[model samples]
Target: MNRTISALKEWLNPDWARHRSVPPFEAGLRPNRRLDEGTALLPEAEFEPDDVVIRDNGEVVFSSGDGIFTLADGVVTRVATLGGQVGTLLVAEDRMIAAVDGVGLVTIDADGAATDLCTDAELAACVTDLTLLPDGIVLATIGSRAVPDWSAALVADDRSGRIVRVDGSRAEVVAEGLGWPGGIENSGAGEVLVSLGFDHRVERRAVTALAKAGTAVGTNLPVYPGRIATCTDGWWVAAPYARNRFTELLLDEPELLREMTATIRQDQWFVPRLRCPDPYTDTLQLGQLRVHGVIKPWAPARSYGLAFRIDQRGRIAEGVHSRADSDRHGVTGVASRDGRIVVAARGFRNLIEPQKDKER
Candidate 1:
């Protein structure tokens, strides 16, 4: 497939190629509706964020699909195209780092030298989220997929998914069977907090026994919680693509509340895709065809962006990539350190706009 067409296909039918084997009826589900507020129209100008990074000295670094975007105090200073999907940026010790999709991690040291820190295979494992530990240990998510395309669905990917620890060439799986883990953060006590995307829950795993010992601390979040951050006190989980509304289940006992919450099903007839038979197979097969409550890209108020934060207990101190500044589709990658938000937004508006121009 041509690169442009393939990219557009990934954008248009995000779940098609990977979920082909599963029956459509089983695969598709109607989403539970929230109180339908009138559709909200955010200005297009506000949503045009490129691959960007921030430096410690108040320098804004960004790339617009082609070159580097130089900024001083949040104003664009220069622009240069550095080809690739720039995911997350890390500013450490006077240096800047950009995690590019497919091309491992790149670090620009103090003297402005850029170097690769990890390998492509290590990155292709889909390191959706990352966190830097005090002792040079970097925790990242290696998400699994039922079929490769299913991963595009932004749901479950448990089989091949893992929480990996990277300390310069020493890569190890600390946690396994994590469902499309979208968020990673370091707990103040040396533990790693991860968001189980498909499962809609938050988890904490000790750094040492990450492969084996870990437990789910919070459960039953409303929708897919993408980015997570931690501060001096508690935590913040962002449900970027959550149902438009939320409700608190006021139950007496925590255990009873947990049990009751687990029983709620957003789509009863939608068959959940679990795993694949072989590692190499990427196509999905549909068993049945059913369409109900399917989300359309043209629908208003259907934005999907990264949302999460870390703060004091019982109160959210700071938040991230607000719903006001998000796109309707595409995978959004998020990471934060010391209160700075690094975001990577990927989508295919280029293909659509050109066609619209032709018709006009």
Candidate 2:
């Protein structure tokens, strides 16, 4: 690990970002998709996939502004990306909820109504990820990730991160001091498990008083455990990388993790930024240079979409399972239940348009 970090440092040069190429969508100011006539599909139908997920029965749910597609065994069966850029999707009880970043949270009933449960303004109160808790409360992560200086970078946002609990129309702050909470889960026994992205740690909180329950057995396990899932085992975590590698952390070794967390405090040597900024904008100093460094000298570029085990324990270490090159663009976010895995690719290009008018 030390050698890798040293190598990265030695190869890091001021000209690194110059050779990097920023994606076309990210280089422009347009949202990935625009609602010209209230129709979901665009005229060109070029909006790419942002996220994906799996249904309870084994259907793969993938998102793109063009439509939401349901895949079975890597084959597309149904597509539904209309009226929103699907940022995240999760199975909540009998229905599914799809979060449309700056738009609003939509609850798709078994019949698929796509009812708006919470709008952009309501969610702006700080809800990033949402999950239905047992007792009628909707558990959500309400945190802000720092604006990255580079593109396609997997580092955590350190500015502001938090957790929230929303019951019907009421909301409450549950936890804070986290590095951009990305994924959330609730234990059957009133414990909420959260993934701290920047910190690369998992933590639990009690529901009653919203007090700190405990840090996950493992700490500093990986750079970005994208999502958290609960299964028959213990707790499952997914870590995505630029090499398109996905790793699932099995918490079955509770004793080993507990001991490791208690003693390990020194920060691990992490790779520096490796993405190029917009080429048209020379204002972003050394942005392109960094990209050149990562591709030319640092190493071949790779990205991990998502990885995790069906069971939370060591019973089965599900290898990194996801589409290759899925991380090339907007792909991120994953959730699993039973024997299924759901991947979500958020369209970060056009989060929300300034000209978009709120429904009156």
Candidate 3:
């Protein structure tokens, strides 16, 4: 009922500024083959990964499936098994905190012993990312409270997401009613920047008073931004999925969206994903239109890979891309290691080093 009214309002007088406007790939956010032309770190793994973090000891650790793995001294090994899907990862001194899908937030110490940090019910589902502040306050993002899955929350326009503060073995939701807080990062001034996924912006939130509305730091994003990590100069942000005109139109029609959600397979929905659906079985769009035996890289694609750097003032500084014709799509996680941007290309099922120049 409520969705129908919202849909009516959108259909009757569509406000381009309110929802459908996407920033063009120009200026600092320009598209490039940096992502597609990069090299995968662990091609042997061949499994989708979530978030990544570089430890104080220079080990690159990442979450995938039910385990946390690390790359140290040119070798990859499983560090811990949390018995559930792991998403976000945070490095704190000799310990690492991870968001386990069904088990809640767990911390693994240097000895590889795992312990539950926060068992908050709100984090049982979509725990996206985590960050630690200068004052030692740890914050995590719950992508949605109303629905467990991202696609369902996106289609329903659910704004039940939150920013959770971790204190010892307990956690509290400091901010609520957010349109999918996809990532959280400390701004080095005692404040934090949050990536609101469905909202398509990065917001600056006060850690001392999070229940209040935050100030938008970055807006007019062309994609649904996710996990944010500190880079050499500023910050590295990952945009896991690009906006599609066809999908945006579906959002404007509640009945059609509901019908498609109820009838079609989720992977085949008109929504964006980490990877594209099988071409032979999915609905065809002109974006995939090939001319002269090649699909242009700038063509509107269902799945897109993007990891960009943003300045301190929240302006995009530079970006890497895997466009329509590239198989290296869905850059969901990002981190900086040895002057190179490390990307967790979930669609490609491996970590990629997408930076020029060499330090080794």
Candidate 4:
């Protein structure tokens, strides 16, 4: 049969064979090697948080789907409602700036007054993340203006994402033609680092040379990088979804991927997802057929959660991981406070904090 011959040819190909040997899911595979052994989930809040930042007053500010909330003493208080899916939050002096999915960048005051910050037509797309610079400017990452569905954009290989700088009412594109720029941060010395999700790498560029091409920093990451945050020693990078062999193998089989995307429902497809509540509905993604009364947590996963710490030079120093069996998946953002690492576990819908050590 033609199908039999095609399988034989694929197995004979050296590259395909090597990649095929790498199992799509391993029984006890933890990429970070249990670096998150002591990490504990924090108290639940009213809504799921996407991003978190430490205010000048030491209060923690986070952006949920519908509003911006502040967390203190394990209590969450809604400070402002953006009326849209909030992506990222930044506290500049006394002002609270946020990037709303359906809306553009806006600044919110203490009394919940919202004012438009960047209204440039080009920057009105899905603003994913933002960071405050030392010079009082704000840098934001736009995923794509053409495709609202980020999942579709990734599979379609949409390269329309961009990075922009916002100063007062003026906005300028710093970099363009990016493949889903998910996170932005100041990388010190007037340079900025951005995480390109679909590209599976991080890039750095100077603020002055906005038109210049970026220098790749973290290359060929095993996971799709989401957000990057600065810490005392270096940077905390969030890897929302782990690498899967099926997705990796499809990188060269564009036609197959296109057919799958066209034929399958978006939610049922074998793409990385942020949340999966019903295990039965996700069996297809697990690359398995469900037998009666036989569901396992360690089932194969197309997505997992991971975070890593990188040095000032952008080299990975340490990491944390949640394997396929774990519930703590989809780590979209990370922050550090008083030596405690806080993670926005988007999949689990809870913030996670590692148990404090008395020695530190």
lDDT of each: 0.46, 0.46, 0.82, 0.73
Residue-by-residue lDDT tens digits, candidate 1, 1-360 = 454665688789986432211111011112211101112112233333333444556455654442445545334543323336554455556665565666666676655556777764656535566778888777777656333333333322235567777777556666776667767777867787777766666777777777763577555543465556554346545444442221111211335444534674423212222211221222112212112533232222223333344344333233332221223223243333354444444331110100011111
**Residue-level lDDT tens digits of model 4 in 1-360:** 655666787778845442322333222123532424544444654467788787656677777787888878877788887757887777778888888765678889988888888777765668878888898988888888678577788678798888888888888887788888888788889988789888878888888885576898777676778888888888888878766666666654777888989899988776778766566666464553445665444555665767777787667776766666556777888887556677787777777764443323
Candidate 2 versus truth, CA RMSD in Å, comes to 15.2
- Could you tell me the TM-score of candidate 3? 0.92
Best by lDDT: 3
- lDDT of model 1, residue 233: 46
* Per-residue lDDT value at 234 in model 4: 82
3 or 4: which has the higher TM-score?
Answer: 3
TM-score of each: 0.56, 0.57, 0.92, 0.83
Judge candidate 3 at residue 133 and give its lDDT.
80
- Scanning candidate 4 in windows of ten residues, the lowest lDDT window is 20-29
| Model 4: lDDT to the true structure | 0.73
Residue range with the least summed lDDT across 10 consecutive positions in model 1: 350-359
Model 4 residue pairs with clashes? none
Off by over 4 Å in 1: 1-54, 61-70, 77-83, 145-158, 232-236, 243-301, 304-306, 310-360
> Which wins on lDDT, candidate 2 or candidate 4?
4
Position 329, candidate 1: lDDT: 29
